[model samples]
Target: MKTMLFSILAALLLFVPNAAAHTYISETTPQDGSTVTENVQQVVLTFEGKIEEGSTFKVIAADGTAYTPQSITLVDGVLTGTFEPALPNETYTVKWDTISQDGHPLSGEFGFTVNAPVEEQVIEKEEESTEQEAAPSVESTQQANDEDAEKSTSPLLLVGGLLVIIIIVSIVALAKRKKA
Candidate 1:
């Protein structure tokens, strides 16, 4: 019986670290796989737990132009990175690396497209010009919105999966204890 209890405790100890090490993003500005209609001046990441001092993140434009944050601040579980001159209209990928409160290193990357709002151009029509300005199609907008919804739920799914694993482990341990 003692051996069985020890085995269960050891198994739980192994899983505990894995659970504690995950410091996932709880919220973000310019969310993953989203389309921003205005200039993005800053990126904010809210984590599930407090982060260390050395935690940092960067933004990379689709054309390989990397923009380092002008200032980064960490307050408890929230990390905010600000950029100067605003990010130009381009698809950007945010990559971040941080040390969680548990001292475990965590890193992740997510991409978003920026479509800054443009001022309407005033053109003097000469002899009834028929030129028309192009606009985004409805289908494309719908697709982008759908993608954003899918990405937003990803963190929730991760938490649900972890809960399921823990529940299964608990059930198994209880069964073993009963048998012993």
Candidate 2:
């Protein structure tokens, strides 16, 4: 009986650390092995648990251009790395390193492809020139002003409604007190 109890306790101790092991990447933007048609300005990694401050990631293009992140931030178990000038058409490999909450070092790598067509770039340039030449119409300006007014009034409307409710409740409470 003593030997059996000792074996069971040893086995339980071995499994406990594994169960509470380091956190891992639960989800990633531009998911691994995916082909995207749009510009990728940021990469986001969501971990199974909160990550430490030193966590970061890098992007390497197929042409061997290494794009370091302009900024890295962590919030609620999610790490985001933003890159300037967006990623062009290329197959990219993302390498990341992070420290888990348990003080263990963790790292991973994933690949994705960006393939934005050249024709869209030309069209976007043409649209920008045309929009620049066009002046804002009177009706559009009025609509924008109306939208701003609505946004500014929203909070005021909510506060007014709450004040009215409070006054009504106060009056009812005073009436009940006199009756009692």
Candidate 3:
């Protein structure tokens, strides 16, 4: 029985290719760990799989500052999101979550560094008017954030819950068999 269980688990893991593998950043605009001489107007991230059309993508800096860009654009299977303005010298983190053509919501993160200072980065997000914004609602953004957190939680809890139930059932069944 143990061998059979192991086999099933191995098979499941094999067939279910890491959902992470299905979507990956193949090439980034700044590239990983690259030091940029000039300021970058956008933090473009290109993925291995095609992002679902009209999906929301986001980039967050390592210092916990998020790039609320002007807009996110998809071209020829590549996702390029334009930053509100160029950022200053510091380590910036890029995070993205989007539904793939395969229908799975994929999300991941990476970081890059810029040599500039903070003041330059601060002005970009301010260029846009808070009142006449064309971006998605804050409510929708919050909902997506909640869903992303849940995705990170569901699989672990599911496996643990299943294992607990299986052990309990096996113990009860064995006790009954011995009594008989």
Candidate 4:
């Protein structure tokens, strides 16, 4: 019984950490619900875990324009989808089915809006104003964080489950040995 418990605990420790590192979007480049005046060049997704190459990231505008960047990069654990000039003021829905470091394909999206055209604002405030505006509101961003937590913690549950399975198998073996 003691040996079986030890084995179960060992399995939990071994498998739980990787499950905690499952793929999730750490942050979005534009962030949630930010009104922008200029056209965005790309949508960058910084993932918590390493993503497999050749996975797809996309932006679908409220205007029904599905813009996909021809190029993708997974450098230093960030997945970037470089786009051309963005669509007009509208909500953008980003989606992806990327392979996680643990070899699972994860997919989700958060929203952002380009409120103003960037060109006119830049032309008007062309004072080279580098003023960093106040941070965007964050109520919506919480959903993305929730997704991250969900991905990272799923492995813990898996570990717990595997531990139970091992414990059961071990108990059965011990019972059989005692009977014999």
Candidate 5:
């Protein structure tokens, strides 16, 4: 009887490590903090281990609207979720929660930005082509350039001023710490 008990204990110990394996995010589409030019129709995430059922995926717009799909499917460690109506231009946060095969709960969030769409880019290119054909006189061209320069100066100054202020604050903080 003691021998049977020892054998059972050894078998259980061998299986414990395999059941406790951790699942992690292996890859993600649109990558964290990246800007995508194309309209996003779906979001894909690959995991290192099998994802269990009852997983949740969400895409939240900058305006705080959450986009949840009807269902999330996990196949061969890859999770695919399709968004209805597609995603528009904005900064979006993708949040996911799932249980790994080991029964561990995993959750994480990532952000990405969507820029102008393909159609808008094509239209802008056509407009630029027409503008170049109807080139303005030298005087008007110079005036437009001057206006653009004036419009761009204020923002540049603001950014530069902010950088200078940050540097000054950093130096003062470090000097006080040194004196102490």
Candidate 6:
């Protein structure tokens, strides 16, 4: 009976730390794997618990350029970081490394694409067709518009779908860990 009691106590002790290992991200600005039409000057991540001061956030552009925020401020479990002017039409990944309140290190990476404005896309196409012998017909322009819309929306749908799957899996894993 003494041995059984000791075993139970040991199991409970081992499970406690795992349960409190890290704080979960309650929400984030721009969301994970989303596309923003407007300029994004900053990234904000909100956690369910407090984050330590030593936490770091990084922004990496698709061209292999990495940027550190000009400022990082933590207030009421929300960490906000300001960066330079909006990145042009490109995908960027925000990588974060932070210590949870429990002292465990947690890190994650999320991506967002900054899409060019509709006017900008139209201007670029106009410039590209400057050398053409004939003006584009109305039907051809309509078809091009449809194609562009499809191209832009397809990636967003894929990314959104993947994010949903990830969130569902994470919730299940967390639930199981908490139950343990």
Q: What's the CA error at residue 137 for candidate 3, in Å?
A: 31
State the TM-score for model 3: 0.54
Mark the regions of model 5 whose C-alpha exceeds 4 Å error after superposition. Answer: 1-20, 118-180
lDDT of 4: 0.68
- Candidate 3: C-alpha lDDT: 0.60
lDDT of 2 by residue, 40-155 (tens): 66888878788899999999998999999889999987898876556778999999898889887777787788876767645644664777432111110011123323543555
lDDT of 1 by residue, 1-180 (tens): 554565556556545423335466766777777888765668887887788999999999999999999999999888888775567789999998888888868777777887865441112122114543222221121112343345445666676567667666777877888899
Please provide TM-scores, in order, for all candidate models, with all chains considered together.
0.59, 0.61, 0.54, 0.60, 0.55, 0.58
Ranking by TM-score: 2, 4, 1, 6, 5, 3
Span of ten consecutive residues with least summed lDDT in model 1: 134-143
Better by lDDT, candidate 6 or 4: 4
Off by over 4 Å in 6: 1-5, 11-21, 118-180
Put down candidate 5 lDDT per residue, 28-133, tens digits, no spaces: 7767677877656677777777988887789999999988865577898888777644577899998988788878787777778878566865564576477743
How far off is residue 52 in model 6, in Å?
Answer: 1.5
Give the runs in model 4 whose Cα sits over 4 Å from its true position. Answer: 1-21, 118-144, 158-180
Estimate candidate 2's RMSD in Å.
22.5
lDDT of 4 by residue, 1-180 (tens): 686778767775765345234677777777855665555656677776688887777888887888888677888677767653334567888877788877877887777887765665455344324543322222222225677567656766776778777777888888898999
Candidate lDDT (C-alpha), each: 0.69, 0.69, 0.60, 0.68, 0.66, 0.65
Candidate 1 clashes between residue pairs 3 or more apart in a chain or in different chains: none
Model 3: residue 121 alpha-carbon error in angstroms? 13
Please report the TM-score between candidate 1 and the true structure: 0.59
Clashes of 5: 0
TM-score of 6: 0.58
Model 3 is weakest, by summed lDDT over 10 consecutive residues, at 135-144
